[model samples]
Target: MAMEGYRGFLALLVSALLVGFLSVIFTLIWVLHYREGLGWDGTALEFNWHPVLVVTGFVFILGIAIIVYRLPWTWKCSKLLMKSIHAGLNTVAAILAIISLVAVFDFHNAKKIPNMYSLHSWVGLTAVILYILQLLLGFFVFLLPWAPLSLRALLMPIHVYSGLFIFGTVIATVLMGLTEKLIFALPSYSSLPPEGVFTNTLGLLILVFGALIFWIVTRPQWKRPKEPNSVLLQPNGGAPEGVESSMAMNFGNVDKSDSELNNEAAARKRNITLDEAGQRSTM
Candidate 1:
């Protein structure tokens, strides 16, 4: 990113971290002060783990993973290292999500509360399961050596969409979970009790945090600029990777020998560019 963009990114980055950490702190207060301290035992304390882990792992770290590429400083990092970090953070999120799921079920079974009874549980579990699948696919396809660039490009859109989709879905599910917990635990929630108000505020913070991340991710200007050594920069020519990698692919080997192949390349490139430019101008 340019220096000017770096300043903007830095501002938003700090804002995101502040909100994210506030969420973590608020979750702690809610669980420890209101819901009782955390524990692995089959009790409400055990269920408390659900909210904490979800807030930290799914809402916070998972969000960071989603936008890691947008961090201007990390733009200098190797794409493979970035991929590893992305996969690592997501792994943590998935592990925490899975543990939270277990915590909920364990508490439910111990108290005979009935499992998968609420919309929160249903959707939350679905998100976790999907998240795990996403994590596995990302690690195996992106981080592993055997996956080809063609395969990566083909799946890139689906991968990107599913990631953001899951992130948004998890946030919505968290909101539902918070509300559900408040209703069950606080009979006076309708009156807007102190705990209820605080929890609602925390939810709002999380929602805003998500909005900021989406803004950072979706903005064309904030997308990561291609590094010099990026696969797209290779001589063979290929479409750039996700985020800021533009749809620049060599139609043919621009440096290749033979006039016939050269003509073909020129023809293809000219046709596509003119067509695309015309569409944009029309738009």
Candidate 2:
């Protein structure tokens, strides 16, 4: 009913879920269409690419994107350390995305599905390394105490956008790689055979992990405390009660000596004491 803390984390998580959901749906359609394989010869599937590689690369990119959603609230306290890590990771991810985009144009072949496998490989590897560093920094930020709030606000969007662009680039390049085979097939850089258990398992894990992170970030927090008012009814907003009546008492002793207030007698005594003090002073 009521909103709680960490709304941003929740929103990011929701976005990640959507990305992963769309990814699964897209992969399913492509795989079913190309049940045999993504070959040089065109088939029922319009794209001249392997559904498997596209699926793998898409999942990989999605993994980074989804993980970015989880990084923000990972440590709210140590903002400085967190910001530094976040900034570094964003820079790296952006570089990798741009490089991957470049490799897209370097497709070796046009007809047999371009296998700019080297570019994809290098970019993917670097992205994964940076993603891991980002994860470590997210955890590190939680432990720090002096980090600034403003820095966190600025860095979060950069991290998220870079991830989104990276995912987009991966999809585009994978399509190019699928449309035509590499111009010169390098034995070392070929894709693994489709239906490999390891690959499928990894994809499933990414899907599951992304879903979990999204669910966490988007989920609503507990109800916040209501503000207080000055009304004397119950401080807790409960009904007021009547006050008891008792006489206010003066606690002074009525029988005290009046001599203490006898100003004339006190003045005479002061004069006598002064006379005696004058004699003493002179002596």
Candidate 3:
């Protein structure tokens, strides 16, 4: 695959970070300023925690998790370490999302409001549940030592696809939630009050951030470069089976000629035979 230069990738990455930052910051401003601050008191203030955590933890951090593999600074790190970082971020996102759900449920029950009655609620809950499953499967399939390389390879595509799908689902669910909240809270949402406009801007920022992440991840040239493992295997004269699978990402990089391995094996056998014969004769 033709690897693209870092200049373009860096530019897009910077833009993504900026947009994600703005989205989270805007969410905080909306809740703290316009919505009269946050709390855990089974009030609307507590419900405010939902949007704040979702944007900061779930949306922004999750976006970071998805594109982490493409980060140039992390290139020198072991693939296992990189995978850990990716999974760690996702786990944090899931935790925050669960907390946000608790906040919403508590506030609703306190206010005697019905729950799970809207499409936004349904989709959001479903997405979060699937996200959790994805995290667990990813840990077992990619991080665990027992899983064979072939299994990892087979599941990698599904893992990646599900992760992206969950991300997109959450984005859609968030947009729906925003619109729903505005319709009820603003009542005159058609007139576009300051709160409505500000919240809408937050939604737009989220869209931009999501787009940048997907673009970065889907670009073939932006994939993390494979390390050259053949150099390390040269001393052995032949590479171990599944050495390529161990690095996994560089399935094509580890290699040695069959003839070289055969020659080395024969020479080593002859040396052992000669040493044994000389020892016996001396005795």
User: Higher-lDDT candidate among 1 and 3?
Assistant: 3
lDDT of 1 by residue, 125-169 (tens): 889888888888898888997887777767778899999999999
Candidate 2 lDDT, tens digit per residue, 24-104?
A: 555554455423433333342323233343343344344543454245444343434544554555445445444433433
- Output the lDDT of residue 78, model 1: 86
TM-score of each: 0.81, 0.30, 0.81
The C-alpha stretches of model 2 lying farther than 4 A from their native spots are 1-77, 109-202, 222-283
Model 3 RMSD in Å is 9.1
- Candidate 3, 116-205: lDDT as tens digits: 999999999999999999999998878777876556656777899999999999999999999998888788789888999999999999
Output the worst ten-in-a-row residue range by lDDT, candidate 1: 243-252
Q: Indicate the residue-level lDDT of 40 in model 3.
A: 93
Error of 2 at 126 (Å): 21
Off by over 4 Å in 3: 1-3, 230-283
lDDT (C-alpha) at residue 237 in model 1:
45
Per-model clash counts, in order, read 0, 16, 0
Native-referenced Cα lDDT, model 3: 0.88
**Candidate 1 Cα lDDT to native:** 0.86
